[model samples]
Target: MTTSSGSSSHVTDARGPLHTGPGDQHIYYGDIRASASSDRSGRDPRQVAVEELRALRRRFVDPVGSDRARELLEDKRAVMLTAGRGHGARTAAKVFLCQLPQGSRRFRELVDQAEEGDSAGRALDREQVERGAALLLDLSTVSSRRYETFMAELPWFLKVVRECDAWLAVVLPALWRAGFEHVFRGLVVRLERPDPAAVLQAHLRDVGIHVRRAEVAVPELEHELTTATMAQTADLSEDIRAARENAPPGSGFAAWLKTALAARAPGAQDVEAHLSGLDSGAQRALLLTTALLHGARTDTVHEAAARLARAAELPEVATPLLHHRTLTARLAEIKAAAHRGRVRFTVAGYDAGVRRWFWDNYPQLRGPLADWLRTAPGFTALERADRLELVTRFAHERLRTGPPDGLAALAERWSGPSASPEELTMAARALGEGVVHARYGSHFRQQLYRWAQDTALPGHRAHVVIGVCSEVLSRRFPDQAMIRLRHVSRHREQGVRVTAREALARITDSDDRLYRSLLKRLAPGEEPRGLRDLGIFLHVADPARMAGDATVGALLADHWTAALAHLPPRRWEQPLRAWLERAHTRPVARRPALRALATACARQRAAFGAVYAAACSWAAGDPARRRTVNALWEAAGSVPRPQPSRTAAAAR
Candidate 1:
């Protein structure tokens, strides 16, 4: 295609921006214009983002290395240089941003160990930590909100935000150092007396921090130093802490509340005294929160409730704890914390304390925790809503889990409000529907096992069967229900594997007594009847010979119909495989049965019923058994006897 321009045509220069081809789906903007120049190579867009991020860090960085911010710049620069692609760069940035807020924690730890002369490093480190933390907060908000239009390019945003976080760290600490609170102090002075005692007392007076003992007033004229003078001194922190504790709530108001409290709120100790003085429910709520803050972990209903009761008297607050204003506030905060998706109790001791303290503060959170745990994987299977309530209460109230303890802190949380067994059954049914529910049931069953201390074979078998069945149903037919589960009868304390004598008795009962005199000599456990046990009675009745019976073939054919009528054929295979693997003696019955079932299913592909499977699985495993069955069929002229010999039908 060629075009000739007339005299009125537009003029163009040699260096004119040429129109490149329109971009495909990757352009992100949906714009027709391409980002690449006419002579550009098809390099990755993420690379461009990384380069831009590096450039941004350089823009904020000061070269003198004197501005502690250089450290931040260096960190961000390293990420960009290492992150060559978009995802790499973006992920790095996201992680850094997430980790930045934690930097303050690092700073605080350093400050604790930091010595006298390393002041510069402490100050610098402090700046870095706080900035990192702030940056992380911002990045989390932005990334969560997805701020960029060409958002497919994550590396660019990551690099930019990471650098921003580093810079913020450097800047924030400096802002604090720049008399952020002293500025407030100056304003307080202008507004009122700037009296440390008065200001501190005012903030704490109505709040829970009361004067356990008032300090002897130091004469103002005698000391010569005001709140400002003491604040400026290097030992001000130590003095402020002592004063906050001993000189009344407001004694060290200017220094303590403004500086120290800004970094770490002083509540646990202050409110704790009042907590002990409150009624049981209130005290329990508080202690639970405190425990959580200290990194305590507990889930047993009995244990948690007991701990709460032991730590704080619940009986005292039974009447008014529900209505207390402080309790209400504390519950609201803990709920908010849980919603934030960071309910981990991992701090050395603070998390545990916080957890127990929080529960003590609010008795109502018991409902929410129960509801939450009900939806949690293993916990959901709890048969009783009240059981869930008990469990959550226990976790919040009395548990102490962390590096400090390896034991499950047991304590009863619900001597007052336990649910009925019917409620538990309903809960169990709902919870048992999912894999998560199965896990919860397993946990609950284990608890039962522990209590019974009866690891007897029969008891163990019952538990194992239930667990295995639940797992298979959950994993294989995720959406299926356990309909028609009329009863769950558990076997008593029998040994693990079935004994020969018992097997004989079981088989005798399982035999089709239609020709009672015919099989009078049959083993007790090896019943050949298809209808008496619904296929399960004969399941293990015969230890030596039941499975070898020729009737098993016809029996399977008959029972397959009922099995299909209950569970759809699509899901039958898993249960069948499970039964074979667990109940059958073959080395790898489950996998082989599964393979055989799959092969049998190849033809039907979509259609399924009981007869089809029975035929396919009629005689599997031993080739000799298959030959004998064929010979037997021929010998009887295709007439199957009521029951065949066990040895004759061995595995082919």
Candidate 2:
């Protein structure tokens, strides 16, 4: 019953010959024979069987039948016995049989053939006979359990299997398919049966096969292990090798046994149960081991760390395993990998234990700290103090070595509300460097503004940054420096306010154009506080000579009018004296500024009359001021008086 297609196309039954397909072939395992030319044209029957098995698995629960199907079953049986444990295959076979049409004649014929082929040197090939035995054990029905009928079918298959050393390998898969643990227990029961050899001898005698020797001697069985003699008789080595080779990822007897005994942790419950059973010391050791190998990044490892932390009552034990040289040294390679950014974990305050462990070793693990600061999750979970500490440390480290390329951005990030004094200083220094040295200074200008608005930054620290900025800007960015100093002057700290004001004064005094520029930016009624003092220094403090300068006089009149109006009457004498003396002694060409000063002073006649009179006397000798003096006198006299109140009229 073979064909060139490599699948069995024909089978003989009471109905005579049946053709399965165009090119099917049948293989006889017990007797090796050369096939006809036509039968040899296609693939090997074993390979075809493997392909069909894979196809069946892919189909998942498809019905299977036909002579070719029977042939493929034989192929599975052969491979399962020799190269694989029958567990996976037997399970698959049961499912496949369950899916077959119930009353299909072809399937029934295959079942009958499987039964008849069970005897030694029977009508079927040895492989076919083995498949028949597996089929019978896996035959499930509503009336009887699959394994309950194993004894009834045993007599038939026992004839062929008794001669084979691999009988256990062949039969175990069938039993395993029925129930994983029950099969192993059943083997132990059979082995421990009193005079098991005699029981088999009786069965053989009933079949008219005289057994001269007790070749089937049962060995004592222990609950833990099958006896060595029984193992040898069953050829356990072949079964073990076969199981390993052919077991699917999560199937097979070993996998089933592991599942049954909870050997491997398949989930959290299993893991928890196992740890629960350990002694306190063992549990601690397990936690330490987990911490050593798995950081808190993964949920499982984090859970393990949490469990250990809960069990630890003392601070010493609560310390993470990474702090222990005994554990950490062994994981140096993993640490190296983590440092290279190949692995990611956050030691932030998301978990107290993780935080303590990470920070303790942060110095050694700083290689990835910058990247983590930039990208790791849970950074915000760190407490404000810890964040400040880490950010400051990183900023200083960056500044010292000259930040790695493109890493200056991290320094800017630290200049926030939570920024420590050290961190704010670093941020300011970075900004100063960018302004003075980096080509991308403007790019960070907005960042500086943002930092400026961080009101939570300590006053002293903010003052320091303001100082750095003012100094840098005075030289390199005088215009911006003026604005920044003006803003900082309004701060709540008197020292900071004074520092900014002084900085503005120095900047204004050093550069006249900058002084004028600063004045121009001040709105008429709203003079900047930083420059309020500057107006006095320039216009009123040394006013005697300053009045003689047109620029100084105009600046005073335009923006510092209120400052001018508020200047003490006593302080006005010096500028007026200097103006009059200059008019009297110097040439007329310079007198316009003095005259302008006189007009501005006359406008403030209520406050400046006495200083104006002193100036009039000093200017009396100057030819240009003869009219100027009379004009000043008249201007002073024409000052309007305040209106009386209605209450005053009632009193009258």
RMSD of each: 28.2, 41.3
* TM-score against native, each model: 0.23, 0.29
Error of 1 at 87 (Å): 29
Candidate 2: regions farther than 4 A off: 1-425, 436-439, 450-458, 524-552, 566-597, 609-652
How does each model score on lDDT? Answer: 0.29, 0.37
**Could you give candidate 1's per-residue lDDT for residues 1-652 as a string of tens digits?**
0011210011121111111111121211111011101112322222232233333332221122222222343444222111111112222233332233332111111111021123332211222232232232111112222222112333343445455343222111101222222212221100112244433333344344433214313453224324333122213334345446644554444444344323333347744664555554543444453343222222332234344453443454344745645533443433312223222322222443454555566655554544433333233222233343333334424232211111121211110024222323222222222212211322322222332222232322222223222222212221110110001111232221122112222212212221121122122222322121222322322212222233432333333333443434443553453343332343323233333333323322343435334323644655643443343223333233232223211110
* lDDT tens per residue, model 2, 475-534: 434455565565555555555555555556554543333444455444322244423443
Top-scoring candidate (lDDT): 2
- In TM-score terms, candidate 2 sits at 0.29
Which candidate has the highest TM-score of all? 2
